[model samples]
Target: MPVNLPEIESMELYPVAGVKLGWAQGHIKKANRKDVLVIELCEGASVAGVFTLNRFCAAPVTLCRQHLAGNKGIRALVVNTGCANAGTGEQGMLDAKKTCNAVAELLAIPQDAVLPFSTGVILENLPMDRLLAALPNAVNNLAEDNWKDAAYSIMTTDVAPKAVSEQLNIAGKQVVVTGISKGAGMIHPNMATMLGYLATDAGIEQSLLTEITKEIADLSFNCISVDGDTSTNDSFIIIASGQSEVQFNSREQAGFAELYQSLLASAQKLAQAIVRDGEGATKFMSVNVHGAKTMAEAKAVGFAIGKSPLVKTAFFASDPNLGRILAAIGYAARECDSLNDLDTNLIDLYLGDVLVADKGGLAKSYKEADGQNIMNRAEIDMTVKLNRGDVDVTIWTCDFSYEYVRINADYRS
Candidate 1:
């Protein structure tokens, strides 16, 4: 049973003001599918981004970071799904630059304005010629209304393309925020292996666009986890073209808040869609941790519990294994030295209140039926109370199953 979000399907994307959208099916990988996507940014539009924090990040991530940091208005973003352009050392950097150069030449934009992103097997060299050959076709197919096709073109293991759009009212006029993302596995906090492209038709300052992007991504991509593994090449970019006449004043305008909230909502909507389509996931789980000493402690505990293999397996088995849940909490709290006697003993597991575990041991009142019923739901909410402070946070995760292994084992093929 697929959980359908109406907001996703009912999303209305306003045509980008000056940007012409396009994509290509470059045979950069062996998938024989459309392995490349291109989104040509309007000249002088502000660009902001967030990239993976992995120390061994891919060449494209490194290059994109530098390109975004330079802060000059960008003209285009070119992406491929066959090679991550990572772990190839100097040659990889050269290849990334070459890919950008090729895109710049074909689009008649400067190479510096072109950003490159690659996702696929790491350590393998990219098939530059195959990717290059598809550029002319992609350019010729550029259209503002083909975002859905562009979204699908960049997918690898994703069963379906992920995208979302939202309408916001600014100064009594409607503004649009449209976005697309790609990710299936190797997803976790600290920047998962996801690539997202967000476009808005509202007019705003470059610095303000950068601020909104960092803020929204922190609340969206940085808060979700699928497998607890960060990929080498993960990046997200947002482009804002003042195509709409709605001008936002960073200091005086209250409409900016509404617009930013809309953008964050759209980003989170896409992020959850990625989790729903997670490889081998049957149930989407969200853990909310409250009453901790601080938000940091809350997140630490939440991610620890969310990423626990035992908890994930319990979810797969559809068993409310309270012990595994409590154990994960203890270990995670120990890392932060936040556990106290009350914190240790006050914790209780309610297999719907059968008291499956209490005070760090199995409860005699535990029942198998209660556990089974809780796991039956497609959406499971796990709550953890620290009993120490009011600080709290939430995290998203998915159940692990045998199919996950099957998918990853043959992922490269």
Candidate 2:
């Protein structure tokens, strides 16, 4: 079960003015599921995207980069679930291009104006026959208030739909931002097995939007880890429709900071939701590392602890095996190039609010029962005071459970 995740029925999401979403039952890999999604943008919307760093990325990821580089002014996005379309050679690229071309023709736009995304079992070819047959159904059903369905349509292994909305007043005009993301496993920094789309009514210059996309990715998508595996079909896109009166040409412009913060808040919520809904996750952990010389060194220690199988499993069994964490931190300082020698004698480790370890060993006042109590909670916080420099970073992760292995063992069955 997902750790401390909210129910979809309790969510109320706002819609961006120029974006309309529609979904269809394409049966890409399963019957009666919403597997095809189309999101159409208005004429003047500006789009920026960040993709996976995996060397063998999916076919649609390749095509999406090419289409965005073409500068034809993107007008629509098409997504399919249950077939990654990776490791299929040249036919995969052709299939991806065909999806873009078909969506463009349906919307009466240039072919290069469309971006495509896919998620699911890797190395298998996408089921184009069912996907193409379902396109008309999705396109004809486009509506402005379908964010919930759009979220569901993109799920592969996710147990819950991740979506969020934020509003802020800019120059007395109301600006709206809405976004959705999906991921459950094969999650790590450098993106994940996920697809995120964020749309706003406030206008942003193309160059600035691109720069902000990378920044937002670093702060949000790049700060989560689950199962320590990165996927080949990750994508995060931001679209500014320029439909509202609040428009900015640069970071220094008025209202840009407010609007950007709203967007960042929305992104952080959506990104954390993925970690909360991690596959077979029973405990959500926030690993915080402070007093580092640089953000990179802080993140290195956080990930080293977050991705360590021994550390994750210890939390799962409600064990206070503190040595595993200290071991991870030691190796992180040695492995990461950004940090010089680290002194554990000056470090302090806390599980929840209780100080457990310090001075290169267990604290005299630390109790095993206190550590066990925090580990048993649905949500836990691990704070590390590196005592090196002054940078602080937070990485979200989840504990591995018996069900985690069960799910992956039978994933293809």
RMSD values, in order shown: 2.6, 1.2
CA deviation > 4 Å runs, candidate 1:
1-12, 249-252, 334-342, 348-368
TM-score of 1: 0.92
Worst 10 residues of 1 by lDDT: 1-10
Query: What lDDT would each prediction earn against the true structure?
Result: 0.79, 0.90
Lowest-lDDT window of 10 residues in candidate 2? 3-12
Best by TM-score: 2
Instruction: Write one digit per residue (lDDT tens) for candidate 2, span 1-413.
Output: 67777766324778789999999999999999999999999998999999999999999999999989987799999999999998888999999989988898899999899999999898999888999999999999898889999999999888889888877898899998999999989999788678999999999989999999999988988899998899999999999999988888999988888988988888888888899988888989999998999988998999999989999999989898988999899889665886557888988999999998877789999999998889889899999999889899899999999888987888777
Model 2 has an lDDT value of 0.90
Estimate TM-scores for all models.
0.92, 0.98
